[model samples]
Target chain A: MNRLNGTLLRTSLRRRSFSTADNVDGNLQGSKVQIFDRHLKRKQRDRAAWLINRKDSLVNTVADNLLDRLEDVKKTFPTTLCLGGSLEAIRRSVRGRGAIQKLIMMDSSYDMVKLCKDAEKDLASDNIETSFMVGDEEYLPIQASSVDLVISCLGLHWTNDLPGAMIQSRLALKPDGLFLAAIFGGETLKELRIACTIAHMEREGGVSPRISPLAQVRDAGNLLTRAGFTLPGVDVDEYQVRYNSALELIEHLRAMGETNALVNRIKFLKKDTALATAAVYESMFAAEDGTIPATFQVIYMTGWREHESQQKAKRRGSATVSFQDIQKEFGAGETT
Target chain B: MVRANRVVEISKTLSEILVCPLSKQPLRVCEKSNSLISDAIGVSFPIVDGIPCLVPKDGKIIEAEVSRDGDSANTKRRYHQDGTGGS
Candidate 1:
């Protein structure tokens, strides 16, 4: 019985560590060490879905910020693919806008996908059709040149190969199709990360990867260009949300289905370590009001599939005015 | 928390855009089974609550007989009024 139990535990532990990317790309199998375990993430998100209908404060806010960029576009998209934008948030916002006609919503979690039923009801008289799909964005599963627009909000951070995912999305777009995304990047949850690091070290004399690394802001533009997207653009934005305490922030992360799912992540924090983490967070970042602030950095990536109708840059030497005349012609006030 | 072999009823409009996650080939409904079949991939994907579960690792759901007047009746009503790009 003892031997059987040990085998069972080892098997379960090994299964739990299986990551998503290796299966998506066979070449990466047995060679690369990936961080996020996609199945564990799905299970985590699935379990979280049962507890709350939770249109998360940070997720909805960032989604709204991402969608607001659509108004600047002159034309509407006939078929738009939304990967992991919160259903309740996006459905209500798109009711009046002509931005999308047929929206394909995809997520890795079936529970999250099921939430679409309740979300769609709020779109009464909106005259839009949506198809919800359960998929890991790494595989994408979209046909080349199928969609008019592909947008993702705060979803790609967990992807094992973000660059490969971006390339797949680019290939899935129709010519001149737009790809716009907002990913949590650049120093998100810095305070919590620091607090957890300190607490773990003090309690256990060592640290494990408590938080997953995110994409850097400086690399955003190059990622798009590497994916062969045309007219790429990248921008950064930050939002601050105040939690009564660090424990409350952790609770919010759970509610948001944003718990750490890194493959090598410590399974659970010790009770004393948890208390220490909260205390450390309070000392370092608490405001006069006794609330702690969590900062989220959003990186927005925009690009387009190459098309004949899209604008193009002129030849290198074709400019009428030279750079040497910048001071004389356009430098002061009369350049216009 | 996920159950095995679940059948979800969905709309005809939704069937149009769904392609096999493995092959990216258009999927067809096996009217007898009500599962989305991809001939190219030779695998049937399961749907839960109108959302097609495309990931293969979670495994296929148990076959359940879904009727037009059943769980998907709600979706059919909305599809009739709002479905665009329908054949």
Candidate 2:
């Protein structure tokens, strides 16, 4: 479990059904409703492999922003693992420096892995090797205490067992190893969520959960700490993208492989329900200029595998100055 | 990779850190079969186009190979989950 005190957390861990065991479909009578369908997600990503390889604008932005975290660290990570996004982008972000000696790229989707492998074939040689593998985040393929760094970008939200995935990642790290990741936070796509809810409630007489649930930013640090990580740091970033209309926004989600992957989701919305949703989206949430605003919240998390050499917080009651004295020294009502 | 001219194989660095997701045992690269095999787990994972498909669902049982090796007196069965060699 990721504990609350670490910095650097890797996201984008896919929980694929690689068990070789199959449960009967439409069998939600007794079992809990699965939020995301791992099989469908793999197919969806495979379908979007071309778009991902070509660098969709939003994907590029998030991947670039996430990789920027590496610039602050001074130590070299001899073994580095990355999941999601393009390999070319990863190579560019870590370019020219000695931070990574052997870079391993992994993804649950075979097509996506192939897309990345095809793009960065030149990086492999006798000295620096790049290995690509089809791996599920829920079941990591690395040995314990093996890798120095692990980075995940824009993919963890799909995992059914998010905590388990994080735990496996922690196990894959050596002491003092770093984990950096970016995941969709709770506030992401709020406009879409609201629009869909209102639209369905109006048309179908009740609302169904259409949007995928995201992890809350507040819980990220705690989760990391509980996962056996120390010195955790978490931050949230929001981006607003404007579409010409709500319909365009939905289309954008479809093309970018961001459509709902919920297993218990309604297979299709009635034609009028969709139209009503679009109308509701435009009327209730759109800007005065008639543009639809989609809010995207990303929670960036970081943590370090606990090690003896790492710094620790000082004990309590160690302050040099008392609260009243500090207040008086700065500025208070009765300093005398 | 250098796979253009030579046989496609898992690199030394990668094999060092990789393990069976099910049994958590170190994988031995079998270049002849283009797969990563773990005799201890009696499972082998295929490597296609230089990418290792290590998913458990895709794993293949290799008990026959392990039994053949057991016939020889040189190696001991040290990888069994129960810590005893299987009969």
Candidate 3:
């Protein structure tokens, strides 16, 4: 019995190390070592029916919001580079807009590029010329300062070098060119994370990594600044998606190619542990309507390249009015 | 086969804009061999199913003798003479 206990303890400790290593590093950001397998991602994307079913709803919603923002811009963009090729909804939104001349859809996954190419045939029109290419976000093949606009939706979060990719994007844009993107934020899948950790600890006496680290809302603004963008804006929007059970949510995630892809992730989970995790998730986050609620936090960011025509900040200490004078003038006025 | 043709068709425009991921030098398409040759690095990236495999590991480096400056001119002439290029 003692020997068995010792073995179990060693196994548990080994499992715990995988999840705790990132905390030891004191940062959740990915380093030079790639955590995601681009080949696996491509294979997953090859299942056309699965991608269409799992991603259509969320992609459509996000695309609509992005389109509304694009419509607000006064200037027209002639050439646009889209990072992710799974952009059917965005294609539809940009269609019939005479302002856009060329749309270059790029993705690291071959299947994704192929899918977009097939879809491009249907979108063929005189207004916008569309093309697809298989290209990595980190090593963009675009020429410097060539594109008028750059847009990415639900794609950049998978990149190991997010900051580098952003810098490449900034360099790809023309002067004063616009950059807009949306990615999953830190708060995404919080309920599932909690449930999985608790279930793993209870079942195996320790926990392993089950979710990828996501960027925080605060990190978005800082990243844009580091990437040399002007007038950067970052905001978060929370989406609550209800599912029949926790297992159903997992299925949707798998179909969307959002499964755990951490390089240090445990290769497999025991059947009992998985079932226990589902039970815990349902018990913890289920609503009165007998469905579990999963939160998806989307972070939206927008920035522009430096241009002579754009507005500039006033010089420091340039204000003529003193604070004391304003206070004195307002202090005598009575409150209504 | 159709997908491969589509990729080649797209490459006509893309080859002009894309560069070597490592050397950042302009890429030249070898139509006979269906590869993108980077003279700076002497690495040829294969065009698989119409999509150019620009990933570093997928590229083939030319032999040392062919890559050397002394024999590069002769190697280029030989490469153009024979249709086969990459390993």
Candidate 4:
């Protein structure tokens, strides 16, 4: 048994080394950058304040959609893990569903976890078991193949190692367990991205990364497959939120804890450049009402760990009927 | 008494399941050291305000803290300073 355990550990370490190599190569190509600070205390501080004043409509919408999908599954997920700080939203949605027996709430920032715990206090009851942990999504601290379901909303986009995080999520789940997540996709903040780029180039002769590079909706399915998930499904939900001006949009982003935290981000935006960006934003994207539209394209994904009970594709040569026979039966004719 | 028992139960469950991020080996929660020790990796991760500071960037700080004041002594000092009985 000891020898077997040693071998298993060695195999796991070897697999991790390969993923680490891919991560390094991705960084060099600028396709995957370590932009967000791994230590998310700054983000937590901003987000806590935001949650207190206003409702997180975007995340709440995503949470509602996730719950709707979970309802269709028609199975009680006895052990559920809620990733990120949107515990209250999830807890409310999952309540009375009788789906979760034990729920583990985890977040990268300690402050976010504290906020979740505080929120839990008001809703405490003896029916369902719940706990909180400060843990990063990329490097989840949970044991492998122990969880029944893992859900993350509006958080996976900030990860530097998104594919690694997905792989870790899969590893944390038991066979046939579900992984559901929503992230801001490539079209998010399109107007702001353009304005910021032009403003920086005109003023500083160069542009720094002001917005995070979000995963494209087209690539979500591929990412899930690459992470060893089966029956991967990816879809998009677009929302157009109108702001009085670009400045308000920027303020909204800050409150959402979505401000630029890239390591290579400019320390400060020049006063002149900031004004220019706002001007450009208004000129290009403003509506007749003097409000500018910010596009938020949310990409939702669902994947399940491979299990024998799940459907499988037929063997290549196992079909009873041939394609040529079907065509002949339909009286196929070639015409130009 | 019930609350105290619940706290102990939670701590025990956490210690049983938590493992070293690097080595993936089970971590021993040394109540005397106030840290989680990974015997395979020979590294200790400090617990701050009851939350484990397990991020790799904080490893150096944990090492320094452990070496500066021996584990048991530091734990004792903290318990006395905070005026809270040891866990």
Separate DockQ for every predicted complex: 0.40, 0.64, 0.38, 0.27
3 against 4, candidate with superior DockQ: 3
- Write one digit per residue (lDDT tens) for candidate 2, span A1-336: 111101112322221222224434312111223568877777777776765434456667777787788778886788988865344466555663446878888877788788777767555443556788887776678899999888888777777667667877888898889998888888888877778778787889887668877788988987798777888999999989889988778766765667788776888889998988888878888898888888989888989999988899878988787887788877776665
Interface DockQ of candidate 2: 0.64
What is the iRMS for every candidate structure? Answer: 1.9, 0.9, 2.0, 2.2
Clashes of each: 2, 32, 0, 0
Off by over 4 Å in 4: A1-33, A40-54, A85-87, A124-126, A319-336, B1-17, B46-50, B58-87
For candidate 1, write residues A73-125 as lDDT tens digits. Answer: 88688888888645456666665464587888888888877876566775576
For each candidate, what TM-score against the reference? 0.78, 0.77, 0.80, 0.78
Point to the candidate with the largest TM-score. Answer: 3
Instruction: Encode model 2's per-residue lDDT on B1-87: one tens digit a residue.
Output: 555433445677677888987767888877667788877878889888778888777789985555554555324544454466764
Instruction: Tell me the tens digit of each residue's lDDT in model 4 across A150-212.
Output: 999878887766777888889879999999998888889988889988888898898777886
* Model 1 chain A lowest lDDT segment of ten: A1-10
Candidate 3 global TM-score: 0.80
In the predicted model 1, the residue pairs found to clash are B5-B61, B5-B62
RMSD of each: 11.4, 8.2, 8.0, 9.6
